[model samples]
Target: MDVDNTKPKPDTVTLRWSYSPITYFEGPFRFKENNCCWEFFDGSATATINAKYPVNKSQIKNDLNKRIESIFNASLIYNHTPYKVSEPFMEGYDSKGNLWITPVPINLNLSVSGPNIVIKDSNGNAIEDMKGNRLRDIEEFAKLSIKYSGDPAAQAILRNYKSAVGEPNSEFCHFYAIREVLTTRFWSATKVRSCLNLKKDDWTKLGKLCNEIPVQQGRHQGQKYEQFRKATNVELEEARIIVKTMVKQFFNYLQNSESH
Candidate 1:
């Protein structure tokens, strides 16, 4: 049998995925890409892409994966906890309503607990606090990172923050990298301290804990193994708090500066 090869193909596709730990915002958060629209909600996200012609599904999947990973990395910086997404499954329909499926494997092991964090509603009212900071504040910081996604300095900060979250043994080193990046990008120590409302002594202590001390977690790379000692849990926690506060404050400063 002969077939006609001049038929038009579908110009749009939709990709869906499950993500965790589940987080709640005031409403669906939406953004636009080159030819795509991404909408993220409580526990799942969907991306709708428009193409002038049929495109490779594999390439679309890879691009979507990277985008989601970057967003989750930003979330990790703000929430101080990790967020993950399952592999995306793509679906679309032809002009005649024939469904096409690109069978991407999805393994969803979502937790049954409440939302990892609850952001403010559309009106910007504050929600309950998490880890001494408002959930809304966390959302705002993540959004700021997304807004500056194209900036090289923002990218470095995000990458280093992700490393800090992943490598507890060398977390102080990674966290300090974030500070260095901010400093290089024109955030002076005085500015950071003022933004975070931290005292000079406190800022000096943070530097000593992360950089000067000869601890296994510190940033002294050339020290002999015998010269370094394990950082206490209390010390690690203190450093984490200080660095996290600095990051949050920096992002907040960026947001305010952008507004005016």
Candidate 2:
């Protein structure tokens, strides 16, 4: 019962589950956002196996272990640290060498009691009574939010989720040793050089233009001049911030809609 209460919870995944093949999920299970547990609605959660694909209990447990490994892999990085794999179901403590920032050891166990598939925390804590397909479920809510949010505020919410939890359904989080993989860098002067294929610091004027354009304008005048070299310093910064913001919003929109 010695759980590491000090570790931060970083607004962990808020998701829903499903068995039907709609939108982003085509497998036996799916994770969804804004999904209710009740079967009254169209996108509500469901048991992983209907009578159709009824897998044996042992097979189900093994699949659950594979899925748990997929969710938290020791080789991969989250917030620059690999998600440490722990023993099945029983809770794990940092012991004497425990660091303050690291997450508690992850649990990898599944069971079936009654008609439910049970997942346990490291300390033998029963986390959820899913129907033996919890880990592989798409983390629906996260997927839906990322795929359906079109507004700036909504897209921003999904961005915050991505920052907190590397996509739970990310390929490595989804394939292989289980799950595959999914920054932006460069300063104003460096950015200009890359766009024009020119040497760094080739033009002092662009640095000025990139700086002059205020962020509130919501427009990028990158093409006003015939050549990328023609851009001035202020215009470069102006164009940089303006174009960057626009692109950011656009991609966020695309990400939020791809699920459905």
Candidate 3:
């Protein structure tokens, strides 16, 4: 009988990945819990996962990507600015210097495009921005998204909100879809508005802008192309702000209800 001498593969591994552009949150922000850790800095960000058992590297990458998405989504919700992170370059290895995964070059160039609104105090010092206290708010909102991850309605609203952020041409339609998600669940515009604590005038105006107007960006596909006019930036911005407020209020209501 021949004895096999091949060493068994290790069960434990550590995976690390980095992505950019760095989040708007003031950093270096660090989180370490549940076998996962991450750090966000001004010009760089990295996340790590310590797996006690064998896990797929691709799955780790996907999870990290979703986290990044949630962070960006939180940014949009709070700052009314659409931000995106580049695909993370990931690698995995064991304690014995055995490489389980190879480092992939980050070839994608992503930009953090938004107004860095800074408030100045008396004299010549920058007082506040979207960082300090706002970072805590963004973190809380992102965690709320994770807490409500099981609810279909909440997920739909988040998905539509993200889509609206990415699609500048059809921004109003996507934002309106968020309201539609609520209306579908509640089955009444009034009830939906009441639940979200939205004003009647504001809700009606949003609907009118998306459904009644003959804009090229209108939600209705049946409208003739020649009959539609482009929606102005002012109209788009108004829709974005109103929808953002509605989402924030809705999330707050959910958080409050869950606590009781």
Candidate 4:
């Protein structure tokens, strides 16, 4: 096969290939594709990513650092020497001891799973304990904790700032603040689910509410609400044991009587 050896090969860029957009909390977060290593008329090179997300180029070069490895696990895999993930980037090196600037093939991708995000946090005590708008449940709880912890006339500081540099009063305030935060955040919803025997669907309202968790936290409250609405086909697995048991017993009784 006659091939033109003149043109430079295309590079790989940080791009997301297999992802369900609905699962994300933010949008306008773009995805890219590159390294079509078979496009030119000469069949020499392909369109490809540029060795980094368009947002950051140096990220790939410095991805092998320890700070990145601490929060993220890095492994380089593929045609021999693999791709490694580093903070702010993922990079691949070829067998030739050279940086594989080409868009790393999907099968040869330098994947990074962590910096794991909390896809979901179900570490609360109870759900029924929440009131008001189901969508604002977490926020409502947070607001309550904050408001209740602060009082000028109160002897003990009720804030939850926990640090070594706290004054005597800061420590007291932080204690209650943390306690209330824990009870409301974890005990009220997630952790309490197993205790309550609540199935996943039983937590639908909570899930719906959680969808409103702003990807930007404080800024895009509206966007968070929209993201929840946009979440496609989010089904919760639920079971009512008593209901199931009763149905089984009824069926058995009918079956036995019919046989007799």
Rank order (by lDDT, best first): 1, 3, 2, 4
lDDT per residue for candidate 3 within 184-260, as digits (tens), equals: 97899989888778999999889988888888666974686667788888888778778888878877888998879
Q: Which stretches of candidate 1 lie over 4 Å from their true place?
A: 1-12, 18-45, 48-63, 82-86, 106-135, 191-199, 221-227
All candidates: TM-score? 0.68, 0.20, 0.76, 0.16
Q: Return model 3's CA RMSD, one decimal.
A: 8.1
Alpha-carbon runs more than 4 Å astray in model 3: 1-35, 42-44, 53-59, 79-87, 91-101, 125-127, 221-227
83-166 per-residue lDDT for model 1 (tens digits): 567888887766566767767666666543244444676898757445335334544565576666777877787788888877
lDDT of 3: 0.68
Can you tell me which runs of candidate 4 are displaced by over 4 Å? 1-103, 106-236, 239-260
Task: Identify the superior model by TM-score, candidate 2 or candidate 3.
Answer: 3
lDDT of each: 0.69, 0.30, 0.68, 0.27
Better of 2 and 3 by lDDT: 3
TM-score of 2: 0.20
Q: Whose TM-score is higher: candidate 1's or candidate 3's?
A: 3
Model 3, poorest ten-residue lDDT window? 1-10
